[model samples]
Target chain A: MLLKAEKITKQFLRESRNTNQFCAVQETDFTLEAGSFAILTGRSGSGKSTFLHMLSGLMTPTSGRVLIQEKEIYSLSDKDLSAFRNQHIGVIPQGQSALYSLNVLENICLPYTLYHKNAHQEEALALMEQLEIAHLQAAYPSELSGGELRRMAIARAFLRKPELILADEPTSDLDDENTKIVFAFLQKAAREGAAVLAVTHETDVSQFADKVFCMKAGVLTEQNSL
Target chain B: MKLANSLPVRNLKGKPVRTAVLLLLTTLLTLTVFGGTLMIISLKTGLHSLESRLGADIMVVPYEATTKSNLETIVLQGATGYFYMDNEKYQKIASCEGIGQISAQFFLASASSGCCSLSVQIIGFDPDTDFTITPWIKKSYAQNLQKFDIVVGNDLNAFVGDTLTFYGVDCHVAAKLDKTGTSFDTAVFTNSETIKALIQSSVDKNMNEFKNINPDAVVSCVLINVAEGYTVEEVLNDINIHVKKVKAIQTKDMISGVSDSLSGIADIISLLIAVVWIAGIIILLLAFTMSVNERKKEFAVLRMLGASQRKLAAMVMQEALLVCLLGSLLGIGLGLLILLPFNQLIEELLNLPFLLPSAGQMLTDTIAAVLVSVLSGGIAVSASAFRISRMDTALILRGEN
Candidate 1:
C-alpha cells in the first residue's frame, strides 16, 4: 500500500449554531495501492478537498490515524513530518498556487530549494516541455494565463518524483484539450509506479482512472471501476 | 543555492516601492538615534573641557570691564577685547587675607591690518608667578618660552615655527596647544616680556587703547586661588572689600550660564529621539502586519509544499533583517556627513562649547545604533511572523477563510 486512512474524521466548531459542532468529513477508511490511478468525484462542499488535505499531511484528523507505507504520518514531529512529505509526497493544490514573487522555473524547483538541495534543471526542463510550458519558464505567475498556471502547478508537483501524488481539483480551470493533457500526465505517472489520487468534477476523468470513488454529505463510497 | 536567489530577496526585489519605503523608515530611525546621541556627548565634553580650562577660583578685573560686560564677551563668547587696571591694584589683591596664589595677566587685541594675517586675542602671563596657563601650555611645549616665542591655540591658523606679526612686532610660534573647545582656542599665548614689547609697538603705532599709559605699570587682570579652609565666596568678598578699583568674580559663576543652556538643549534632543523611536517602531509594526496578512495565501501554499512553520516565520524575519541592516548603515553614513563637517557651525549657532568624542567612542556609537535599529525591526515584525506561521493552510488554500 502507498497510502491508507483508518477511521479518519474532521470536525469544525460552528460558532453561531446551537449544535456548536460540524463534521466536515465523517469516519472514513481508505487505502491507495502502488501503481494505481484513483479519482475522487463529489459535488461542492462534499468534503473531498478536506479528505485530500488530510492525506497530504496538511490537515490533522480529529479522530483516528493516517498511515502512508504502514507509517503513521501524524505521529512524527513537525520537522520530521515536513521532511518526510517533501521527500515522499507531492501535492498540487487547487486554484492559483504560484508564489507570485518567483518565476515559473523557480516555483517548479521550490521543493528542492526549500531543503537547500541542488535542483536537477534538466529534469525540470523536460517536465516543462512535456506540459508545453517550456517557453514560459522565465515568466512570472501574474503574466501567465489560467491554463498555463494550472499546468505549471502540475509540473511543480511532479518535480520531486514522489511515490504518491495528491491533487485537489487540479484541472478545474483547464479547457477540454488542456484537461486531457493533465489527465494523461497523471496516468503516465501512475503507469511508472507512482500512486496518483486526484479530486475532480470532470466527467472525462473516468477514462483515465483505474478506480473511482464518490463523496456526498461528508460520507464516501467506492464506485465500480470503469 | 545562493542566498541572493532566496525567496525573501526575490520578494523584496519584486516590489521596489514597498522595500524602499521600509528602508526609508528604518533610515530615519537610526539617523535620529545616532545624531542625537553624538550631539549630546559633544556638548557635555565641551562643557567639561571649559570648566577645567578656567583654572582660577576667582578673577579680579577692572570694575568698568564688568559694567560693559566686556570680560564675559571676551572669555565666554569668543570675542576679542582688552582692558587694564593700575598694577598697584594687583598688589592690593595679593595682600588680601585668604589669598593662596596670585598672578597678573596682560591682554591685547591684534588689528586686522596688512602686517597681520588675522585679528586675534593676545594673552600674556607672568612666567614666574603664573599658575594657570603654564600647566596647560607645558603639555605641548616642555621647554621655557624664549623672549619672542609664542604658543598658538588649536583653532588658530598659525603653526609651530611660523611667525605671526602683531602691531609690527613679529613673534615666532613655539608649539600649538591642545583643543579646549573654548574661546582660548582662538587666542595666542606668550610670556610677559614678549607681550610688553608688542604693547610698546602698539603704543608707538597709535593703536594702544589706553593713551599715555606705561605697559609695565598696568595689568589687564589678576587670577587668584583661595587658601585652604577658605571658600571661594569668602575670598571674593574679601577682595571686593579691600580692592579699590577691581571687580571680584567667581569662575564658577561665569560658567553656570553656559551649563544651564547645555542642559536645556540636551533634554530637547533626548525627547526628540524618544518621539522618533516610538513612532518608527509603531509604523513598522503596522506595515509588517498588513503585508503578512495580505499574503496569507502565498504562505499557505508554501506550507502545502512542505515548508515547516519555522521556515515560514524565518523567511519573514530574514526579509526584515535585510532591510534594517542596509538602512542603518545608510543612516550612520548620513549622520557622519552632516554632523562632523558642520560641527563648528553648530557650536556658533548654539553659542556653547562643542567637542566631538574620540574616534573609538564614535565607532562604538555607530555599532550600537545599527544593532538597536535592526533589533527594533525584528521586534516589530515578530508578531506578524508568528501569526502567519500558525495560519490554517487548508482553509487558506481553498479560499474558505
Candidate 2:
C-alpha cells in the first residue's frame, strides 16, 4: 500500500457540559495505491470529511496509525506534519477558494513557496497547459469563471507533485461539463504517478475514480471498481 | 516601492483601515512614552544649567533650609537674613592654603518701588576681589562698568533701570542678564561697595541705633571659592580654624538644604508623567496582542510555510521597534520644539531655571525607547504565538468554529 490507516478513530469532547467524549469517526481502515484515484463518499454528517482529514494527516486519529511511504505520519510531530503537508502531501480545503490574495499562478505555485522548494514555474505552466487551463493562468480567483476557478483549485492541490492528493467537495459548484473536465485532470494527475483521494457526496466524481469507498457511522467500505 | 519588492508591503495596503489604525495607535503610544520621558529629561537639563550658572564653590549661611532663592538682595541686598558677620573675617578666612578666592555677600531687606512694594533682596560683593562676583561681572562689563554700576539678573530685569530708592541709596542698572530661572534671577546686582554704602546708609537712617552698631560687621555671607587641589571640606576646615563667628557650607550642602526640597516637588511631577508613559506601554501591549489574535490564520499559514516561531516573534518585535523609533523621534522633535523656547517656562515650574535635552541625550533616549518597545513586543508576540501554534492545523483546514 502507498498509503495506509489502521484502527483509527476520532473523538469530540464537550467543555461546557462536562460530558463524556463522543466519537466522530472510529476504527477507520483504508489503503490506496500510488497510481489510483479513490473517492470517499457518504451523505452529510457520515464522517467522510473527518476520514479524509485523517487520511491526509491533517487530523490525527485518537488510537491508530496512518502511514505514507512506510513512515507513520500521525506519529510525527506537528512541525514535521506541517512539512509533510507542504511537500509530501497536498490538501484542497473547501469553502475558501484559491487563497484570497493569490493570482491563479501564485495559487498554483503556493506549495513551492510554502515548502521553500524549487520555484518550478516552468512545471506549473506545463501543468496548466496540460490541463487546458493555461488561458486563465494570470487571473485572480475572483476574476475566473466557476469552471476556471475549479481548475485553479485543482492546480493548487497537485502543485507539489505529492505522493497523494486530497480534495474535499472540490467541484460541488461546477457544471456537469466542468465536472467531467475536473475529473479528467484528476485522472491525469493519478496517471502521472500521484494517488488522488477525493471526498464527495456527489456520484459524478466518484464514477471517474478507479476505486470508491462509501463511509457510514465512521466505517468505510471500499468498492472494487467504480 | 516597486511591486517586485513590495508584495509583502502590498499586503498592508490590501487592508488599509486596519493597518492605519495599527500604525496610528503605535504612534500615539510611542509619542506618549517619549514625550513624558523627554519632559523629565528637559527638567533635568534645566536644573543642570541652573547649577552651572550658580557658580558658587562654597556658601556660608544659617542652617535653616528652604527652596526659594533670590539672586539680588540676598547676594545684593545686605543685612536681610539672620547672620551679619564682621566683614573683617573675610581676610582671615582667605589665609587658608586651599582658599584661593572668596566673595562676601550681604542680603539687604525688601525695598519698595514706585507704586507696588515688590519683594526685593540685594547682595554686596567686591567685584574686584570676590570670585563669585567676578563671573557675574563679566556679564555686566560689556554694558557700562562704574563704581555704582549694577547688572540685574534675568527676572529682576523686569524691574530693570527702574530707579528704586533702597534706604535712599540710588543706583542705575548698567546691564541685565538673561533669566537664570533661579532666585538670583529675581535679584539685582550692584557693586559691593555700593551695597555696603547702601546698608550703612540704611543703618544710618535709623540713626538712633548708630551707637550700638559695629562698622566692621557688614556683609551677609562669605562665598568661598576653594583651590583646585583641595575640596570644600579642606576649605571649610581651614576657614573654621582660621576664622571666627562665621559658618561655611559647600555648594552641594547648600543645594541639598535648598534645591533638594524644590527638586523633591519636581520629582513628584515627573513621577506622574512616568505613570502616563507606563500606561501608554500597557495599552500598546494590549493593541499588539489583539493584532496577534486577529491574525491567527495568517501566522498559522506562515508557520505551515516553514516560517519559524522565532522569525514570527522577530517580525513583531521589529514592527514594534519601528513604531517606537518613529514615535520617539516625533516625541523628541516635539519635545525640542516645546523646550527650545518654552524651556524657560519648564525651568520656572521645576525651578531648574533652564532645560533642553541635548542631541546626545536625545539619541540615548531614542535607543532606549526602541530597545524597550521591541523587548515588550517580543514578549507579547511570544505569548500569543504560543497559544496560536498550539492550535490544531486541522481546525484551520476544516474551517471549524
Tens digits of lDDT, candidate 2, A25-67: 8787778899999888888778888888787776778888899
DockQ of 2: 0.20
What's the distance in Å from true for residue B45, model 2?
A: 3.5
Candidate 2: C-alpha RMSD after superposition: 7.5
For model 2, the superposed segments whose C-alpha errors exceed 4 Å read A97-108, A115-153, A173-181, B1-13, B55-101, B104-222, B225-274, B299-345, B348-351
Q: Model 1, A39-145: lDDT tens per residue? A: 99999999999999999999999997999989899998878788888888989999999988889998999889888888777888899999999999999999999
Native contacts recovered, each model:
0.60, 0.24
What's model 2's lDDT at A146? Answer: 73
Q: Tell me the TM-score for chain B of model 1.
A: 0.93
Q: What is the DockQ of candidate 1?
A: 0.72
The estimated TM-scores of all candidates read: 0.94, 0.70
RMSD to native, candidate 1: 2.4
lDDT by residue (B1-401, candidate 1, tens digit) is 68888888998887788899999999989999999999998999899888877789998999986653567788877788888899999988999988998999999898863323668888999999999999899999999999889998898887888987888888899999998778788888999999989888898999987777789998999999999999999999999998877899998888888898999999999999999989999999999998888889988988888888899899999999898998899899999999889988888899899988889989999999999899989999999999988899999999987
